[model samples]
Target: MSSQPVQGLPILPGSTFRDPTKTAFHRSQTLSYKNGFAFKQTPTVGIGGTRLYVNQLSQAELDELSNKRPTLTYGQPKQAPPSDFIPAHVAFDKKVLKFDGYFQEDVPISTEEHFRIRQVGIYYYLEDDSMSVMEPIVENSGMPQGKLIKRQRLPKNDCGDHYHWKDLNRGINITIYGKTFRIVDCDAFTETFLQSQGIELNPPEKMIFDPYTELRNMPLRMYVTPSDFDQLKQFLTFDRMVSLGFVALVLHRILSQRTFPSCVLEISDQEVLEWFTSKDFAVGKSTTLLGRSFFIYNCDEFTRQYYQDKFGITDFQPVNIKKQPPEEIKQIIPPYNGYGFLEDSLQNCFSLIPQPPRKNIIKMLENDRKVLRYAVRLESPRPEDEKRQFILSYCLATDMISIYEPPVRNSGIIGGKFLGKTRVPKPGSSTENPVYYEPSDFTVGAMVEVFSHRFIIVDVDEYVMNYIEHNLESFPASVVESMRNHFAPRKAAKEALKK
Candidate 1:
């Protein structure tokens, strides 16, 4: 049969598969193979051989494939709410308070209620009150306001016995004098005062008293109520009088009623005495006594002298004078000879006491000294079947040998080996009842018998042995021979075989 040329077939440049029967180039513009493989012809460039670039499906093919496949529909796309549609619950306030200054609210007071000024703030009490009518105010102006928007009452009577200040619950309000005010918070001074009085309350979450905004010249207006105004005014007047050196003689009279015959009486102006005695106002005796009189015993040297010169009081003694020991006669007593007279005198005069040497520095110095250590396997004559491993240390200075054994129980050895030293008993003693020996007891190369086992002072540490080897000429021939002959494994093995 004559081979017929396929017409209308698009040429695939650089394609290796040219057999028309096995692989057909279709009009749909895709290459299909009878061997069940579909390949798309792509652009090619010739190097040593044809290089074909595989192409992804074209846009038309992708659209056709997408249409043929069933289109999956998830739920409809989320739609944003209309711009003007606000929820019914949303509320806005037009009249926002812009002032940074503290504002006072009028709190209503009743006969049944009494307000206690606590460190945490003012608290109110009622027989069956469960909640306090106070609003939570957040103070930060720079940040967005907190979510708590409305005024809420705190649970009350939870602590029990509101009459006792210590028992009153925290975060509650008390109506004082027909006005509404929340005890916003308290300060450290107030908290300390309550703690001193044995009244415990929850500490205020925040400090309400701003030092920069606190009015120092005027009394705290927040604490002053209509009922307390007259009393405060009188108290202020009394305070001013005391500041002006006016004595409250009524206090002296009260003290005189309780005074003994030995008490000293200091007389004051008759007019001043009469004025205080006539007034019906509450006179706080402690405040009056502390504020009015200057105790001679508490006076400093300068103050005492001034009082003595001005007031003719010569019997005053300091309240807090330190009692000193009687002076010693240095000529009669022998001086301390422990550290030399001159050194002691210098130390006492200049505070030049010698300090103990640093342990770390001493340890570092000790570390610099070469320590000769060796590991050896020992065999006991009585325990023929058993073998014990020991670490031996040789002291070069004293020519002594120290031996150590592995601990009964491993205490976490790193790197799969117990390299650290374990305490070894003295030659005649057991491990449980250990008795260590002095370094001068053993000489180098000596076969010391320990635990009834012969332990040849076999080896020195590698570094120490190497150092000795390099400086062998400096050492005695006998000493060198002993070091070299110590712990010969071949000789030991031969001796063991003969035994």
Candidate 2:
């Protein structure tokens, strides 16, 4: 195929022009033409290979070539739209302090994706010295004008393909076929970068940085919206404020509210007034507007059932919503949009709901109530039986090993079978002694059995085992038993080979 001629204008490859033949190529890319100045022509394909050469030019083409080129070479492409602006939608709920309007868009044909910001203004109220003051603030509507910088599109599934934008100090980056594109522009989000440098967002400003290497991976979290919150009102607890579980639950409720718009009383307009008057939502008696515990359980009973089904849990009840005293309700729950009284019978039971226990990290880790086994170096050198005796002695001294579970393969065998670096014996029992094993098997996240107790390995790996072998003197029976699994299969296989 012949190389297309460059338009009479200065031509760069891959650029489209109305008249390609009149395009003038750089002298480096062309041979001398009839006009003496090298002109770009389509490639002439021959058996040898593709080559470019100029033949002749008309008087009109000569006249066009004589014109001087424009000084600006890298201005916006003429084909780009004159003024581009992204469109967006915004909604609000009562619990939301503010919602930022921005989203990411998918890119077709390539691995890259684009980000968009909806240009919108939000008005809200903030407390100032115990007084509610109306505040109007403008958060930039969408991602600043820049290229999609570092990005990676995760493999697509039912949830749709997800991509991450690695925001450089200067601009957002996106990955296209594993290549990073660092967008160069005046407007970029460097909120995290500035914060790391001890800068605050009292006054929002565009981030500025020199384009460097393109990034291919980064994390992106969707900011929670107020409508996403839930109000269970069924379960409330005193310790909820101290434990972050309450807050996370409240955030989940808010997420659910945002996700399901039809059921809840949306607080967008005078609807907040209706919700405040509704029996489902009781202030102070039901929930303090800002109480984390109250917000999480304020949903209707059906909503609670939905959550219970979704999480595969039997106990979705929030606990003790009907136990509040009227006097307590009067003191804590403030009246919004008037109408505080819910009549005689209902008002008699006005109390803040009792919440469930908060699930903290410590509590979660301890809930299983299983035995904890750790390998300890023996104080003195000992033989195999002596080592077991010493380990048992220590366990006896500490009362730590009350139970143990033996492996499928017993010891006292010459060889065993190997599976994924673990040794399994060819079916022996308590009648036979268990085999000794190498220390490499019982690292973190591994499984081991001692006497009767089954243990899930935690915190140490092969590297640590090696370190202990070099640093510590002896391996106790518990560790030895765990390590034995690694070599059990090998021993069995070797026995089979001998047979």
Highest TM-score: give the candidate number.
1
**Residues 61-80 of candidate 2: C-alpha lDDT, one tens digit per residue:** 76665552342444444676
Whole-model lDDT values for every prediction: 0.42, 0.35
Reference-based lDDT, residue 164, model 1: 33
Question: Count of backbone clashes for each model?
Answer: 10, 68
| Off by more than 4 A, model 2 | 1-391, 394-397, 401-499
